[model samples]
Target: MSFIPVNEPLLNGNEKKYLAECIDTGWISSEGPFIQRFEKEFAESVGRKYAIAVSNGTAALDAAVEALGLAPGDEVILPTFTIISCISQIVRAGLVPVLVDSDPVTWNMDVTQVEAKISPRTKAIMAVHIYGLPIDMAPLLDIARRYGLKVIEDAAEMHGQTYHGRPCGSFGDISIFSFYPNKHITTGEGGMIVTNDDHLASECRSLRNLCFQPHKRFVHERLGWNLRMTNLQAALGVAQLERLPEFVQRKRQMGALYQSGLAGVSGLQLPLASTSYAENIYWVFGVILDASVPFDAEEAMRRLGKMGIGTRPFFWSMHEQPVFQKMGLFCGERHPVSENMSRRGFYVPSGLGLTQEQQETVIDAVRTIMDS
Candidate 1:
């Protein structure tokens, strides 16, 4: 039996054809037609007016922060339960990251906590759509509106999720996506920032290209970084984007199967879908181990890996991480829920191309571990 990995990219003839054309035309580098086409298509699909492709998700965050014109002493609020890359960019952009605990049920930023943390220095709120589940945006938006703050969405894991009939990325002032190899769509390693503001969009493009040559070459402007994505990546992304709807559908099917398979299990708690959203891509199918259960999430993962079923630990809370502690970011504040979830939570295999038998194998392995 082969190991069922967490994610797998599905490609078709279009990707190969475009990649070959790029190679043949000697346009495989940064400047190419595919890159422009991809930016336009991706922006439209996500319901944004503009999209700027970059090297990786982290760079996308940097672009958003820089484009917003965040100043020193500015504070950006984000959930403690998120990838380190989300918080790291705020620090890199010379801003303070105000970390808050997440909602225990949704595993997303707790919107209720936002009001208490609102200070005069608060400039933006970095709302993340965790594990492909869209956050409740109404409250977040209300808070932002009340305080005159911006919203930058970290939508790396969520490609096809919506909130209150609106797309996740479109709710924020600026939103970002990652095309890492394991994501729903892959362009090897790439990212994009989407925004409706023309000025911000142009600023992001300039920031991605070292803030030089808005039109003429060798023209110096504000300092920036070389974070542009290659034409080959965009070629692959265009192919992936064409198949995204099917990919999202298949993920939903597999996720439903996982929920049904573990339905009556005594020692596990399954993730629930949001009532306000119609679609969720299930980027990762996660479960929480009941304390009454005989085994912990880590030990079960180890046992399942031995059974040819690969799994991963949930995101470690940023507040508990040593790097944040060294930087004095939420050092004393204990996010008990986020910390505990990090220990008890683990996600099963959920790839776009995973077969029914492969999913059954994972279900059997997990059941066996619990049954034993």
Candidate 2:
């Protein structure tokens, strides 16, 4: 059998048709009809009043932080188990990132612990929906409301998942999403920021376009990077956004298959099937080695790689990151849950394009390894 890759985007939809239109119309640059259309449609999908498209997810986070006008020394609490992008933008804006532990079940930020971390310096709570599960937003939002803290939701891994009846991106002051090939939808590489605040929307638009002055095209009042997404990407995004519901259903189905097939497998802790807040979309069908397991994810991944199966390790805790340690940030801070996950957690092939036969092959390979 050929090697099963970790992620393969399903581009059978209108990707090609949109790309062709972009090329034919010569509207391939950042400013084009598709860009506006994508921003508007995406905002509507997330129930936001405004959406700003950017080059990638990191840029989206950066723009949101900048648009919030957070002064230096302001603190933003976020999950230590999330990607570096969540903390990087805050750090770059001269803001402090207050790290929180992940919930053992949901693998999302422990919303209960958020209140203890909030200080007078805390200006915002950056809630990152991990894997396919949203952070329990009701409590998070309540805490934010009580404390008057801004909420920045990073829904990068959660495209279709919802909390209660509301969408994942709809709960924040500013929410962001990524359209990388591995995400629920693909624009090859793109991202978006959504918000209801008109002033923030305008600030993000300016930040995305090099902070260009409205009256003077060549002048800028404040410094900003050219983190604009191209019309080519927006065209593809528009097509993808139309099929988001279908994509979400497919992801849930894939997650169900993995959960059923991998059930009763010893020494493996599967991703949560469902929480009280929302069902898991199984972004990549992750698994963690139990303490009884003899090796960490690195060894398991190597063994699987040799068996022609692809896998990816979980994110390392930000508190343990050497870069952060050197900067005297997160000093003496420790999150045991996040640390353990980094060592033992990994996700197998669970992309939208995965086939049944391939999935069975993956299950058999994993069983064979564990049984040995």
Candidate 3:
């Protein structure tokens, strides 16, 4: 009867208790106790030695790109199917972003194309895990090793998810995670760069805080942006991080229910349930309408909206973006899989806040629209 949003955060954990402490103690800036605790515990959770918290996921990308110490005009290869944040800092650093396609089934970057994209100037690989599924890391990591390219893993959609018994964020030379509300964990609005390399971690810490140094304050050896994460955000993150396993379990349950309920629906492409190495975390219960259907995702979303269901469209491929096109990027390049996904794919309400009753309503609504 009422509108069900595409996402709503579940914060019935220690979020309130931590926030109260922040308010009572005046430890509200970037240098508070919760910031260190969140960073330390989160780094340990992901099996990394250090974590640097920042303002948002985009900032994490900026720091990851800058910390690599790659020269201008060096190339970074990444999926065209991922969020624009994946390519933003790469382009800003004057690094050429070599585009790659997505796999038809998994909707993740086709790791096969990565090697072909490598050039003499290739300096890094930005592997962004898509939706609820991870990009296959074995081949990519090997390629990076052989070419001596740094790996920047964007594990923004994956929190407790793993790849072949190892954590998603632990694979990269430097990896990043987002703490947006829709993510597996929420810091209201925050991001973190995690890594085993002590020097890289320290570089990220300085980059995040306007390149500030302990020995010298208000003096800069290099230019860095002010992308510091607030203590209030980290306070929420510390509480949210504690409940990640429970949250992950609930998300999977929600997805399983959708899969079973929507099994009979035709002309719809559901996310892959699992791969040999990892089970799908079902980040947002994404679905793509078959091209044979009379309409596209825009029409399907409109139909769902009328039935009180909120939905989100898949990412628009970087190659097709007007901004990039105007700048003469990805000229004459075609990644067919990502292009098709952009037109037909969209996600439903599969947040942790989604209940069985709400899910059932959504499932029935989708089936009804597709059948007619």
Candidate 4:
């Protein structure tokens, strides 16, 4: 049997047609019809006023931070249980990162803990929808409104997720999505930043292209980087955008299969679905091993690989990493819940195109390993 992957991108015939057209027209560069169509279509899909395509998710984060007009030493609050890009962009923008602990069940940033971290130096909050789950954003948004702080939603792993009937991207002052090959959708290696604020959108568009002015050649308005997405990538994105609704539905079905299959397993706790008027596009069907479980995430992954089942551990806690420790960034910061989760959490095979037979094989392998 072949090794089952944790996540895989599904490319249909529509994507191939668009790619061929882009290649034939020799319009595979930055500016083209596909780029415009993708931005417009994607923004409309997520209920955002504007969406700017970029090179990758990290670049999207950098653009969001730059648009905030944050001064040096201003802090951006975010969960410690997240990828490096979340914190890297904050540091890149010359802002401090106030890392917070996550709730054990939801594996999301604790809203109760966010208020204490806000100070005069606090500028914004970067809420990352960890794994495939949407963070509790209603209370977070209320806090943001009360404190007059910005919210940057890292919706890279959560393309089709929503919160309280509103989409995840719409909740933040600015939100970003990744179209990497393994995400909910793919455009090879592309990203997007969504915003309703016209001024911020204008700034983001300018900054992505070296802040070029229309009137003058070689004119630069501000110091910026080359973060533009290619027309070819956008071509693929446009095709994928049209099929998002169906893809989200398939993803949910896969999640249900995993829950039903693994419900009786003693050592593993499946992800809990949010019923707060929001739907999640289970990007990765993650499971948390109980403390009494015989193995940690790494050991379980090794055993699963032996059974031809591919698995991946959760993101390493940013505050506990060596790079952060050497920088004296969070030497005394303690997030025991997220720290422990990093060791025990792992995701099984859950892709958009997963079949029932494939799911059964994975579930049987996990049961066999745990039952031993």
lDDT of 1: 0.87
lDDT of each: 0.87, 0.91, 0.93, 0.88
Better candidate number, 1 or 4, judged by TM-score:
4
Q: For model 4, how does the per-residue alpha-carbon lDDT over 276-314 read when each residue is reduced to its tens digit?
A: 665556788899899989789999999999999888899
Q: What is the per-residue lDDT of model 2 for residues 23-121, given as tens digits with 9 covering 90 to 100? A: 999999998899999999998998989999999999999999888999999999999999998889888889999999999988989988999998999
Q: Could you say which candidate leads in lDDT?
A: 3
Per-residue lDDT tens digits for candidate 1, residues 59-102, read 99888988899888899999989888888868877799888887
List TM-score per model, in order: 0.96, 0.99, 0.99, 0.97
**Lowest summed lDDT over 10 consecutive residues: which window, candidate 3?**
205-214
Comparison by TM-score, 3 against 4, better one:
3
Which ranges of candidate 2 are over 4 A from the true structure? none
Checking candidate 1 for backbone clashes, the offending pairs are none
- Against the true structure, what is every candidate's RMSD? 1.5, 0.9, 0.8, 1.2
Candidate 4 global Cα RMSD:
1.2
Candidate 3 has which clashing residue pairs, if any?
Answer: none
